[model samples]
Target chain A: MTRLTFPPALHAEWIKIRTLRPQIGALAAVPLATVAFSALAGLGAGDDDILFSAFFGVNFGQIAAIAFGTTAVSAEFHTGALRLSLAAVPRRGSWFAAKLTAIGLPVLAVGLVTGLTALAAGAMTVGPQARDATPAEWVRGTAGCAVYLTLMALLAAGLTTVLRSGVGALSILVPFLLLVSFVLGDVNGNAADFLPDRAGQVVLHSSWDGTLGPWTGLAVSALWTAAAVAAGLWRVRVRDA
Target chain B: MTSIDVHDLTKEYGPRRAVDRITFRVPPGRVTGFLGPNGAGKSTTLRLLLGLDRPTSGTATLAGRPYVSLARPLRHVGALLDAQAAHSSRTGRDHLLVLAASNRIPVRRVDEVLEETGLTPAARRRVRTYSLGMRQRLGIAAALLGDPGVVLLDEPANGLDPEGIVWIRGLLRRLAAEGRTVLVSSHLMNETASFADHLVVLGRGRVLADTALRDFIDARVHPGVRIRTTDPAALENALTRQGHDAVRHPDGHWTVRHARVDDIGPLVSAAGVPLLELSAEEGTLEQAYLALTAVDAEFAARQHEEVRP
Candidate 1:
């Protein structure tokens, strides 16, 4: 008999995500929504932090990221998918880790590509103001864009595992990301910066007035994702599949 | 050693217990039919065996290791708990491919299983478009993908056509003949009688019977002598004088309960009775199983003792 190991389980999860049509759409929508909206934000031209403006399409793009994360795990909760999955690999820890890894890698790759394309699209619309953006800022923004999107996707997947429903995870994350996060942005001080989305978006700005810096902000978001993932792992360990 | 051993395994969902302290052993080279009603916890027990559901107390081990602890569980134990467990949007081939990759099974094996299950033509179609029988075939293919030592299937014949049913019976028998431990769960005793060699019956989360298929029927049901003769009065007199209580039917045949044909034939001959037919009237598997698990044990008991001389 062959041994069930982490590497093969991860490969299996990757194939699962790659093959599903809705999951593919969710991944593709990340770049499409990001570049399209980043170009629009560049044309509007009122925001002082041109860096955030260029990456602003992430507001819409992150929704797709969360969808990808949610669907990847939520698919398991469908009729007998998780049972089949666990039957193939009985180690819940390895299977959950593999699932998250599969979610993180693809979004990170797509997020990086989306970052560069959105920056160029934003520069075309913002005119000479885009030239003021330095190489250091571009590198940081792009890296942060990729990492931040990946973290958010991981966060959604973690939540999906906890909720065990794609629609359930989306119902909470998507609306909260769009309405609650935006509304909270207008109402509070640095305390609002601690919210997962706001905290992670800190890196995209060329300058900031918030309490958190670039890496520290993403760290806060990572902590939230970690907590969600821990709870999800616990659920997988204890609950009936 | 047995391939699968479940001991004192219990699962309680709030106040109600789904599986209550049940124990049984599944030996290799035989098909053990897991027979139970819908709410009798057959599926729950299978889930516990596969480590898909945590047990309240006790243990279920495969070859002396908990399923989760096995190095490659699918390679050791293949299970089909639910045919609908596969996602509807994924193609049938991809579904098997994902499982094959998970256990490190080669990709070519996926095609082989598809062809084995007669699903090669529909392998590319999404599961949503497939019929129930196709889904069952897909599920069976996934179970056999690893070609594991132990096979567990639940209600495998639910949506199968007559040909599919025949195919499954042969497949199950062959798996047992190959010395693999096969556990097939169903509520139909007659269906299992065709393929299963041993039986593990459950009713209300408790083991009602576990033994060889023939013994299960033999122990619960008394297959008494069925005698036919031209002179019914002489045969009845001979049977009564031998201390046998024979029931005379309206059709002119006599059914002697708790009586053996070997002992009755000589008695009738000495009594100058000419026999037309002499045989044992064995009870059907369905009749035997129903008697054991019948809703009222008291009634079943009455039926059992109803054969008293």
Candidate 2:
């Protein structure tokens, strides 16, 4: 037997993602929409926190990440390509991990760039009266956005594994992100901090004045991501492909 | 020794069994046609062997080890369960490239397989844009990417045109000639009869017959003597008196059951009957398969009737 040393699963995932033009277009939409929408939202408001204003794109961009991530696995299930994937790499865990990694890295990069550009554009339009974000804020916001997008992608991927359908995964994820955050807004101040979108959005603020600290909010989001991924892993491992 | 060894494999869905204690071996250097009717569990069997779906009981080993146990599985076995299972947006070459990468196979090998499977012209085209035959060729290209010891293809001829079918037949023959164990599943026995040296006939998730092609044909098809003469009644009577069962048709030809043409010439000569035409009628593989499956079909119908009534 030939000693197979290729990263076949990872390579396959990359090819799968890149070949689909819609995925790339979706990834690009985050920054474009963030900058455009945030710029529009910041027009009337003056001298606001540049960091906070710049990240408006990520709020919308993360949706694209979620869609991309969900489809990464769900597309396979829908097309029945999971059989070919499993047949190539019988180790289910490795295949899942490779797919996560391939999708996670690109989403993270897109998130970071979008976050940084949004902040810079907001600051440019707001002029010097805009509270200049500290380097620490820039680092935190950009890095946090990247981490947040990665987690969301992973969460979407996990949810997709559980649902095994693209439309089904999206139906659940979109409502949780768009509607549930508002529904939980007036609940027990401390309790609502654990909601994934709430926790992830905390990364946008320059100050840690919320119920949970910035790091704690991010941690809570991470927890949600871990739980979702663990559930997905369990489903993949136990269920028939 | 480097072959697929499936022992007492069983797979169940809830309370219903899809594959029930089925066992078979696919040896190297020949194509083993996994023949069966629709819903006979051919795909389920391949899924178990490839570890896509776990067997409920027993084991399926590839090259003396379980499929999941192999660190680099593609190097051991390559399988194409569905031709259109690939991401429709991905190009054919990219699809093969991805699989090749996993097995540490060279990227150029993807091109080689593309050429080999005759998908070179459409290598750069998106898979969704390709025709069904092109997609099938692409799937085969992916299977051949690793140059593994064994290749498994399920319903590979499902969507192929006549020309494409002939191409696939030749490709399978060439692959088997190179000493690799090739297992192909198809519901059409006639298509398989041309390329398959050995056959494993399945029905209702069970193996009806596991034997060589020639043996299957011989066992199912009975050789009979066809004698055409003006005195059909006399010849029929003479053959029937000589302990051969003969049937006279409305077309004035006599068909002798369980007798060869060589035996009929001497029988007619000795009986003083002038023979106008005497020839042997060979039984076809199709007839044999129908005879074998007819019994199973009847049993299934009776079982259904008992349940419903």
Candidate 3:
């Protein structure tokens, strides 16, 4: 006689994300791309910050994370999944919250694993420079890397919900992460650091020149995620499924 | 006690009003056919009832409550809006599982529904690889998973094979027999006539007819005298001379509209035509549907955009 709650909805979303082969591959790429790219970046490393070099693979992983988030939301838009999902749950807000949580948790877990692997690989490549980083610094970078990637994935999920197209979200996000963040940084100066990718990535840098500190920078990225998520929720409420 | 009640429901998409101000009730222990043509707003009405789309004006509710207000919606209403609504990459079993999980339904019910819908063999296959018929079965499986009191299915037989069609016919019948309120929408006239006793006929986003199927047919169509004679031309001439409109079939049968057996029996004797077959034919549902829609078309033509229902 109980009402449907958040837990079952979350469980359902979890099952949906895992059952699909492509979604599983998208998630796997989060860690694979991060660790792999970090290893590749290590070979070219001569004299770089010990912590940031270990997390460089995170740059590549962000694209895959965006893909995972975008695909998770976009798949529901196609072929009438939204109709079916709404029919089953009916409460749009509760279902959406569950969907975002389902998207964030796995990416965060995989991102942490990727961070640890990247650090080990960096330690091998940098040789003696790895000892220069304090245990506290290593812990901060690994944890920050995971949280940043999870936030980016959630940001992408929120945008995908609004756009209702994975390609639409990825096309804007992927290119911005690859180039626009840097371009805006040079052109717009300190203001450009507020971009989601740049603001979130600040935690990885051993020394940052931007006005925002590590926590404040992540908070700026979170503000962008919150705005996208709010818009997406409004769209789902006002528009017909 | 549970019934689907729609009150003055209307849906407008820009300038086009897909579902006009229409209202009807689908009560328990009966199969109500929501019959309409392609653009008759059958799908649109069902979407609004299921809370997939908001109505421009009016209310659609189950047991006097809106669909979205139901805490456990799947426990009260099972719906199949589109068979292709499930993601292409998920296995058929997983799609039903997602629905069951969302509703707090037991996992074993998923297996039972799959078995009932004849999708057990293909349950593990991804939806992309399944045929349209298989997808339909999978959709039915999802609908039956919750074992809800009311069932709403739109175009449930769209892609079904003959055997699948027969299977669904029995399934709907059995569901109604169990005293569940079942509403099935379809544009196929004869297919609906076979299973439904109560009918809600929609034409141009309006309720053209809402009554027992027999009453709808009897009201819209007139009975005709079916006559077969050795000399078909002579029989036709006598009926025409008497000012009766007689339609002739390729099989040499003559159907005299608005005429009785007594009207034709005396004439056939006077015409000296050797009669092969003579009987009063009840007006068919097909004839009634055509007559009803044809009238609707004429009104649409006369009024253009101003025609209501």
Candidate 4:
């Protein structure tokens, strides 16, 4: 028997992602929504920590990124698509790894584009205030923004695999991001800092009071994503497709 | 050549055993029809065989290897469990292209399968716009994309029109003729009877009969002759005298069993009886299936009553 390679499997998964208009729409919406919302937030900036204001659009943009990842993985559950997928690639672990790679690369690309546009949008609206973001800070924030968004998307993708429904994953994630993280007062200390959205958003901030720095916060979020992905993998291997 | 070997395979759901200890071998180079009534574990067995579902006990293997263990399984075995198992928004060509790309098959193979399944004309259209027959064709196209040696399709004829049915029959026969192992399952006995050389009939998750199609039809479906004569009484007497148990129907026709029409015709002529109409009635595939399942159902009902009381 001929051994199946990972590249071709990843190619197949990418084809599945690009062929659907909804998935593409979800991906395109990320940058547009992020930049537009951040530009609006930039107009009302109070001069305190203007760097955070520039990338404020990420709060809204992350939703689209999450949707993109969730839909890409969850679409397989609908209409018995996963069965056909598994039939072609019988090694469940490899197929899932390929799936995650497919979701990660596209979101990473789009997230970088979204971060840069959000930065430019902020610079346009806040004028001199945005200039406070030094070149080093600018580079770190943009790179951090891309990584943060990619991690969020992957986290959603993992959750979707567990729930087996795009809508179900979105219901839990969207509300948690919008209501639980934002609306609820930051109950100080390590607990609030560890929430997936808040923990990752530390990178977007120029300075922070919490113990975890930008990279450490992103690492915490990556750990969360890893746990979710591990759970999803375990579910896929054990559950009947 | 590839063959399917199943042994003592069992699957249980809660307290219910969906598949019992069933054993059968499907040889290569023949269309083996997996025949069973609805809820008779045919789908479960197929899932178990494909490694989609783990068996409770025993084993089902293709060419001496479990399906999951086979590297590049699409190159070795192609299976279609559901015809509609595809994204509705993707075009038929794109769907096949994705499967082709997964196996590292050439982009050209996608078009070839589309042409083979007669879906090339509508390949670009989204699958949501397709009819059920068209979807079945697309599923078959995906199944054949790898040009695998073993093909297992569950109810590939579900929503097909007459022309599509004939097309599938020819396709299955041709696939088997290529020395490939073909296992096609369906509850439609006559459709399977037309092309299948071997049959593995299942009832209540058990192998009720596993034999050649001809032998199955011949053994279970008793052949009889329907005879109508100007003088029914004389014809009956002549047949009865010749040790042929001929029974007279209320409609004045006689049914003669265990006697060929040639022997009866000669016997009746010698008895000076004018034969108005004589027709040979052989057992049909449907009849044999019905007869087999009837007993199975009866036994199940009896067991249910005994347990409840």
Candidate 5:
């Protein structure tokens, strides 16, 4: 038998990501929705905080990022795709690793582009109000946006793999990101700051009063993503396709 | 040489055993037909052999190693467990391309398999638009993508048309002739009868018979004598007197059970019965299969009755 290499498996997974329509839609919507909403948020800004307004689109754009990651992994659960995939690359860990790479890289790329776009759109719309932000802050926030979104997407991908359904992952994630991050977190005080979405969102803020700083907040979210990924890998290894 | 070896492989889901502890070997350069009724564990066994599902105990191996141990699995074993396993959004060609790319198989072989499977015209169309037959063809094309040495197909002819079925039959024969091992499972006895060299029949997750196709059929189907006598009444009376149960047919022919043509000829002549014509009818694979499964059906019926209120 020919030796199983990583390149071919990675290429095959990359093909799956680009071929499906929903995945493309989710990926495309990341920048569009993020920039669009940031522009709107910039227009309604009251000059209290400028940088946060510029990255405001991330609030809405992250849904698409998570959707992109979730849909990518969830497609395999349907149509006996996992069986075909595992049959080709018999080692479960290698296939999952390739799949995660396929998922993580694209979402990170799109997330970075969306962050910069949202930043530019926010600066243009909320003109002069955004002038208080330093270039270093802009760079940190932009890079942080990309990393945070990529982490969130990986988190969704991991959950979807465990559930083996795109809908199942979306159902749990969408409501948590929307309701918990926006609504419940407001009333829950310091405890809500550590939730995956809220902790990650600290990077988008220009000034913060939370116990966790921007990078630390991202680390918290990273921990959540790592746990989800570890659980997903364990499930794939033990469960039959 | 043995290409596929399954030893005491069993799989259980909760209280139900999907595959019982059973063993068989498929030699190279031949087609082994896995015959069973629906839910008889044929697909489950294939899944276990391919490592898609872990066995409860024992092992299934390819050449001397487990399937998972193969470096490039698709290069050694090609399996088509479900035709609908292809994502509907992807085109037929894309599906095979993904599989080919996974194993580092050249892209040219993808087109070749499409051409061979008569799927060149619909290769670019999304899989959702294709008919069941087209999907089946696509699955077979994927299985042949790597041009692997061992092919395991579960109900390969499930949705094919008559011509498609004939094409698959010829393709399987050609693959086996190329010294590749082919194990195809199907509930349709007549379909497998035309091409299978070996037969492994299963019932209720257990193997009922494992032998060569010819031997399996011969062992189960008893050859009977067909005779046409001038005096039907005298023939019956003489056969009764000679302790032979000659069953009369609606077409004026009599079938002599458990007796050969030679035995019938001498007995009829000695009994003074004029025999106009006599011939021997060979047993068919379908008859043999039905005879083997009739007991299974009866047992199922009794169990059903036992559960009724």
Candidate 6:
């Protein structure tokens, strides 16, 4: 048998995502919608921390990133191309890792840019309300948003792998993120802060006083991401392509 | 010898058995045609060989090693299972580029295969825009990218035009001539008749026949000698008296099977029969495949009836 030594699967996966129009469109929509929504919201609001307000749209924007990540794998299954991918790279572990890296990097980039742009634009619009917020707070918010988006993207990728269908994965993810989180927040009060979306949302705050601290919230979200990804990897490894 | 060895391969989907104790070897340096009717487990067998699907209780090795055991599998084996099994959004060139990268193949090799498969002009176009024939060509290009020692293609000529079919036939022939093991699965026996040197005939997830093309045809399809004589009655009577099975066709020609053309001339001459034409009718691969499948169909029907009662 010939020894097969292919390049890092990440490079192949990156090309796979980058060339697809839907993924690019989803990535672009994140920042554009974030800045636009934040600017419009900042215009009507009082002189507040416009940076935080500007990025309010990220609450919705991350869903697009999640959708993109989910579709990356699910679309292959939907089109029956997953078999070909397995044929190309038989190592399921490497293939899943590569897909994670490919999806995580772009969503992170878009999250950071959108978060920062929303902060900057909101601060300029809100005048004195945005004052007193330190550069450190802005940096943390931007960096945290990127990390949150990356984790969320991975979570979505994992769910999609297990479900093996874009529509099925999205049906579960959307309600959980949008509706279930809200209902659970009302029911459990501060306890709901541990939920992935709420926990990850802490980093976007310039002011303190969320149910969980920023770092702790990020950690909680990371745990969810890890657990979901592990489950997905396990399913992919054992199941037939 | 760079052959595919399958041992007790079995794959079950719930209670239904997609492949059952299927075992066959595909030797190198020849086109081993994997022939079966639809749903006879041809694709499933190929998937097992490539380790794309987990077998319930068996193993298939390529070139004496499990496919998953090979670190760089593309360098040893290339496969094109489905033409449309590609990311439609990527351009043809980029699709091959990514596969080439995965296999550590040189970027130039991508263009080489594109030219080889006559997909150079459409290299820049998105795969979604490609026609089925073009996609087939692209799939072939991807498979040949590494110039592996073994190639496996499943129904590669499904959507190809006549010209494309001819191109693929020549390509498979050339690859085998270069001593590469080529396993191609197709339901169209006629299409693979001249191209395949060996055959692995499958039926109901089992190896119905695994033998050389010539031997397969000779055994399953009875070879016959066609003699057109001025006195057809005399030729038929002579053949019948000699205990040879000879049938007279509506065209007033006597067709004698299980006999050689050389024997026919002497026998007719000895019987004092006037012979105007003596032609041999050689059996085709299609005839052999049909005969083989017909036997399987009858056996299956009988089994079904027995179980129902």
Against the true structure, what is each candidate's TM-score? Answer: 0.92, 0.93, 0.92, 0.97, 0.93, 0.94
> Would you list the clashing residue pairs of candidate 1?
A80-B85
Which digits, one per residue and each the tens of the lDDT, describe model 5 over residues B1-309? Answer: 539999998999999998889898899999999999898999999999989899999899999899988767887888899999999999999988899888889999999999999999999999999999999999899898888899999899989999999999999999999999999999888899998999999998888899999998888887889999899988888888878878999999999887788887888888888888989977889999998899778987999999999
Better of 1 and 3 by lDDT: 1
- Candidate order by DockQ, highest to lowest? 4, 3, 5, 1, 2, 6
Query: Where is the poorest 10-residue window by lDDT in model 4 chain A?
Result: A181-190
Candidate with the greatest DockQ versus the true structure: 4
Instruction: Give every collision pair in model 2.
Output: A8-B101, A8-B102, A34-A57, A54-A118, A54-A119
For every model shown, the clashing-pair count is 1, 5, 0, 0, 0, 5
| Alpha-carbon shift of residue A131 in model 6 (angstroms) | 1.9
Residue pairs with backbone overlap in model 3: none
Candidate 4 lDDT tens digits, A1-241: 4565677788999999999999999999999989888878877778477778888889999999999999899889977689899888878898999999999998899988988887887788888767677878888889999999999999999999998888999999999999887765555475878988888888888878887788999999999999889999998899877
Question: Which lDDT value does model 6 have at B283?
Answer: 90
Model 3 residue A170 lDDT score? 90
Please report, in order, the local distance difference test score of every candidate based on alpha carbons.
Answer: 0.89, 0.82, 0.87, 0.89, 0.89, 0.85
- Cα DockQ of the candidate 6 complex: 0.54
lDDT of 3 by residue, B218-245 (tens): 8988889998888877887888888999
Write one digit per residue (lDDT tens) for candidate 5, span A61-113: 89999999898898889878899999998889989999999989998999899
Cα-based lDDT at residue B199, candidate 5: 93
Cα displacement (Å) at residue B174, model 5: 1.3
Model 1 lDDT per residue over A1-241, tens place: 4544789899999999998999999999998999888887777888888888999999899999999999899889888889889988888999999999999999999999999988888788877888677878988889999999999999999898888888888999988899988777645355878999998998998987778888999999999999999999999988988
Predicted complexes: DockQ each:
0.62, 0.60, 0.67, 0.72, 0.66, 0.54
Put down candidate 3 lDDT per residue, A13-49, tens digits, no spaces: 9999989888889888988888888878877886467
Q: What is the DockQ of the complex in model 2?
A: 0.60
Off by over 4 Å in 1: A1-4, A185-188, B225-244, B250-254, B259-280, B295-309
Candidate 2 per-residue lDDT, tens place, A198-239, comes to: 887788777655687677888989899888888888888888
